[model samples]
Target: MPSIARVPSVPAPGDAAELRARARGALLGLAVGDALGAPAENLKPSEIRARWGRITGYVTDRPSGTDDTEYAIFSGLLLARHGSALTPAHAEAAWHAWIADRAEGQFRGAGFSERGTLENLRRGLAAPISAQHRHAWSDGLAMRAAPFGVFAAGRPAEAARLVAIDGSVSHDGEGIYGGQAVAAGVAAAMAGAPPITVVASALAVVPDDSWTARSLRRAVAVAHRGERAVRSAVVIGGYPWTDLAPEAVALAFGAYAAADGDFKEAVLTAVNMGRDADTTAAVAGALAGATQGESAIPEEWAAPIGPARGSCLPSMAGHHVLDVADLLTPEVEEGVALVPGTDLEPATDLVRETDPLRHNAWPPPDPTVFVLAPDQDEVRP
Candidate 1:
């Protein structure tokens, strides 16, 4: 669908090795959170308690990620190919080539925003126009925003800008802002920023008066009191839809704040909150994981994440989150392409130029920083 064009890698600022670890942590943590929260999505906190006494770990015997993880892998692949030159046209084409044009069976578990965008695309509507739907304000974009952060590591503003381009085809207004917040937070975390700084980075990206910003402020303000306080401060009870971008993003940031960037605590808190649990937990997991690195995630939690099942986006099936992480922050040497199908002929130049985000910089500053190792395992742990 969307080809991996010749993206000249420039050397980026910061520790390349550490950036690689954080990138791995962000995507892997997202998969873990998605799998852990899948069984608890949409249920109220009380209902969740009634079903499974505060969900501390994977509920199912064969735990696996949902649409949240699949969609992230989809976005990460696109970012790897296009780098900073990604546009709405590229995103739309990828959507059509990898998703909308395919003869999928049932389109299981996709959110309304995705369905609406696909419908519009089939009707010949372009982006910004394809994004015209009632569910355009959902958390769909936020669910896949982490890759932008990984790609534009250390640059919160750049991460926000890139995610907005990706979201333009399926989200608008608050939806776009929510994605930007998550992207900015993860970007800051990737650079080893602390939790407070991560939150500040998120706030710095969106308009101060926007609903997403306000909700984030309220949630973080009450985060010290714990998840329940954070929930009460931000969540609007009886709102019917749990996928609201503002509410979900707030809950995620609140969980991250409450946990003080602890990978286990942040993810578990988000999972227990119940509203859009998968997406919220995924976002929290990405933020915290980036802050703490891949080693921070529990081995038990990391073990369950395998190649995506691709229940939502079939083209993404068989692709592992680790592989996507490697692709985003690649450290390959010589002519071998990080990804299989792509042709990266200039092996030495590719090795010399590892940072993909360099081209996306405002004035083209310095250079920077994928592929999975042959561990032969389900997860890294």
Candidate 2:
């Protein structure tokens, strides 16, 4: 068997202050971008231009994240509790308890893939089976994948592995690949990897020929020509859904590469591109935030971000991203003995024990799942 290439370990943070800043930057950056881009979701570039004239900053007076920020909180809390021991069953149960079994009004702000997962879970389906619905390829998983990267820090492969576990319940195939790419990229960024190496880390996780990988490569290839060219290269014409995993992932990485990991530029570039605006910008924000640290984000942009409004997942209300950031990167103290397994449970036996490569294998494991035809005029809330 050919040996897998070894990825260099990202050095642990030199001190607690740097760790706190990076973690806070990543989650807070995601929320800021999500709020900034909500108004532009599903709109065309021309329409965005006509309405906001390049969208240099927040467009609404009371800018708050939509489904994107809320879902990240949902996933972040789970990762904080489970750490690397997270399993599909744990994720499925979290879905049921926090979302699926909740009141219908609480589930209002989810995206297509989440809606599909909730419906399947409500109907008593289990994961892998539960993920077998239409719209499984949406960017839902990718949008919330940053916490895995933050937790894994310098371990890109571990980040990819954990995110695949989290994604298995709600997405498959390209959708999973998209989340892996983002997780790997953010993991690399958290470790202080350069912009080019960060992008390389992203490409290393998913198969080269997969739609997510191909779109990402194309977008990065033309990133030097600026955001418009990158958008033109990756976006699917005549496709109604703005949340396709491949397209959204590509656009986000493109924005990251274009800005060379500059928080403001990467986020604004994604926001202006218009398709799946919230997700793309949120992803860009995560990547750039991890690379630059929270202090690097503009004060004005970070100010309005309070605890999530929980428009989507009501249980997540009042749970601030900053609080989650602190949880993921706790302050290191002197003379405090670390206790093992005090907070987290031991790894569950229910975890799938397959080769990690099998998760991203070509032709996908199950091809019988139906692909819904794109409806150009359909708008999802």
Error of 2 at 265 (Å): 0.3
| Global lDDT of each candidate | 0.82, 0.80
RMSD of 1: 10.0
Number of colliding residue pairs in model 1: 15
**lDDT per residue as tens, model 1, 77-118:** 778766766788889888887788886534543999988888
Model 1 scores worst on lDDT over the 10 consecutive residues at 372-381
Stretches of candidate 2 exceeding 4 Å from the true structure: 1-8, 106-109, 334-381
lDDT of 2 by residue, 135-230 (tens): 889899999999888877766777788888988889999999999899988888887888888888888889877898889988899999899998
Candidate 2 Cα lDDT to native: 0.80
lDDT of 1: 0.82
Q: How many pairs in model 2 have backbone atoms within 3 A of each other, for residues 3 or more apart or on separate chains, i.e. clashes?
A: 0
